[model samples]
Target: MGIKIIKRQGQTFKDKLFIPAIMGGMKTTLGHFTKNLKDVSNLTTIQYPEEQPTDVATNPRYRGVHRLTKWEDESEKCVACYMCATACPAECIFIDAEERFDGKAEKRPKEFKIDLLECVYCGYCVEACPCDAIRMDTGILSFTGSSREEFVVDKKYLMNNERAKDLSND
Candidate 1:
């Protein structure tokens, strides 16, 4: 079989000079500038921490903060399976499982921590969970901390997050 070769057209004077492309770009820029000048609201500047953008839309499927789900007894649903920690691509999840002494559950997480700096928010940990113990639907887009140690979220904080309570209202 013979290969079919396609012919290409040569550039015109306007294309060679790039005058039309430059004019089109300038027109678009001038239009946006004039529109923004006419209506200040069209500008994308936001005074963060004091004033948030009202027109901004958040994604429903956005994975933000992580929270541990609770059982009916108000105890953590996580059985210390370490599936979340194992599936974490960033290795941000850490779990230390220990046998329960009170006979309430077979095993419990002695220490569960997640480094926010290292977490990629990929939601793989939520998918890898067998008991649906973890969820990333807190709707918290910001996680501010003064120090590196403050970014590390332990099991206690995960279980009693204020954002978790806010999620129930929605």
Candidate 2:
């Protein structure tokens, strides 16, 4: 039975001083600064509030904001199964189920609320929906509100993709 104790190399004065590391970082910063100075017009910076991107919604990979989709008959596509809420990692989604008053025995969410501040935008809610009811394709990013209460969106807001007036760019 033997215990192996690995010998470690002690830091020299130069290594402890960290001059090389600092110089490397400064070199990178100065390199970028000189490059920008040479051709400032070629910068790809977007003037966000004034110049909004045109392809946020059209881009397949862009997941902006949540929206509740609808069936062909203009009815909500949700079946009130609670699968989305169950799958949500953030636990931001809340659903209150209510039986349909119509002859059909279908159920619907009386209160479907998603706290935008709490949501991680992981797209798990959309994938977990069996009825294809929810999606994050509105391209309606940059929302603003006076308080946190205004951030918790309801079913009606999600369905119509509303809250445009709350947009920060507005």
Candidate 3:
């Protein structure tokens, strides 16, 4: 049996004129514009700062602010392996490793810092961590700072931030 091919007819004079397509596009545009203009609530865009989306902190998979996890003893889980720092493509992560005096581990981060301004939120740091020390599940979507220094978060801030503590309940 031979396959039958049906060819589409050429464009009519109306289609060739392009008036119908233009009118259709304009109709769609005007419909949305008028609908949104009449009732602003009809729009799906969330008014940030004043009106936060209800789904902000509800999703576990949502990546937001970065945080450092702690052990049951309240010690930092980061062994200062520098995996996160190395994996960070933005070079936002900075870590100063120091030998542990208590002899519990070979090294620990004396100073760990992340520049939120430079971070691209790629979640590479979290994936690179073998100890589950780093996480981006703080559910913090808004970060405002008056100065550059305010955006640079240190180890102390990451470990003690309220957003970081919220993950424990999950």
lDDT score at residue 28, model 2, on the 0-100 scale: 100
lDDT of 3: 0.85
lDDT of 3 by residue, 73-145 (tens): 7778889999999999999999999887665568889999999999999999999998889988877878899
What does the lDDT read for residue 67 in candidate 1? 91
Which has the greatest TM-score? Answer: 2
A best-first ranking of the candidates according to their TM-score comes to: 2, 1, 3
Please provide, for model 1 over 12-42, each residue's C-alpha lDDT reduced to its tens digit, 9 standing for 90 to 100: 8767888888999999999988988899975
Candidate 2: residue 89 lDDT (0-100): 100
* C-alpha lDDT (0 to 100) for residue 105 of candidate 2: 34
Alpha-carbon RMSD, each predicted model: 3.3, 5.4, 4.0
How much is 118 displaced in model 1, in angstroms?
0.8
The reply for model 3, stretches above 4 Å from the true place, is 1-23, 35-47, 102-104, 163-170
Clashes of 3: 0
Per-model TM-score versus the true fold: 0.78, 0.83, 0.75
Predicted candidate 2 versus true structure: per-residue lDDT over 24-130, tens digit per residue: 99999999999999998988777987787665655676677898876666667787999999999999999998887653338988899999999999999989998
